[model samples]
Target: MVEFGALPLFLCVMGLFSESLCFVTLEVEVGDNVTIWCRHELIVSGYIHWFKHTCGSAPLIIGCKQFFGSVPSQNCFFFNESERMVVSVQGENTSLTITAVNVSDTGLYYCSSTDLMRITFHETNYLRVKGSESRRQSESAGF
Candidate 1:
């Protein structure tokens, strides 16, 4: 008893109700290690993308993972060539870890997925990396 023309609209409404977004703010000190975690729900065959955006800079794809059938998950970093950054996927959970985090790492990290229909943003993490004591003291003293 559903009108053909309204079926799309109904589905859109249902999707809106079923979708959820999570945001987290994190702070760390320089030389510290940090990890951002993301969980995907109801995704069977698709890809998860991790992006980073900083003030006055365009968003960049940092890492990605693909899942298809019985194939194992593959992880790669497009923007980060350094070994200090790593991306790993285990079941429905994925994490991006940064070693010896510094001020340049401060930015917004986003976790999104694509199912060939639309891109769904799952989480946003705002990372603030503070300098060490000596560095902070020197900068404040203008040394």
Candidate 2:
């Protein structure tokens, strides 16, 4: 038999070990196409959501239920063409592709798996969009 007081502590440690989430960062030049990928080890029966978070503003939901064939939300319509912001999902994996990236696209993006209420797994990716001045500086530095 286990000590009653230690049982709760053990469960908490187990929960921490079970929690699975990760993040990645990407840097891209303006007008370039980039793809952000998220994958999970366990099978997800819930929806996958994408969000964009800026420094001062609240996080905006870019897409929801994308793995279940749902379309992206209107707030995600940053590009003129609808297909420019696309989400593709496969078994245990999902990807968000942005075409012709601009300065406005620079921000933190999050991908999460949720049951439409609570998130199960979450990950954040920081996107840095290189501007013309940065490019010129790099060129001058012979980079």
C-alpha lDDT of candidate 2 relative to the true structure: 0.62
Model 2 clashing-pair count = 0
In order of listing, the candidates' clash counts read 0, 0
| Candidate 2 lDDT over residue span 71-134, tens digit each | 3323222323246667667667777889998878887776666554455444467798898966
| Candidate 1 residue lDDT tens string, 25-143 | 78898999999998754257788777787756767888887766356676543343348777777777778899998788887787666676666665567787877764786699998
List the lowest-lDDT window of 10 residues for candidate 1: 13-22
lDDT of 1 at 110: 70
* Model 2 misplaced regions, further than 4 Å: 1-23, 41-44, 66-81, 133-143
What is the C-alpha local distance difference test score of each model? 0.69, 0.62
lDDT score, candidate 2, position 91: 69
Error of 2 at 105 (Å): 0.3
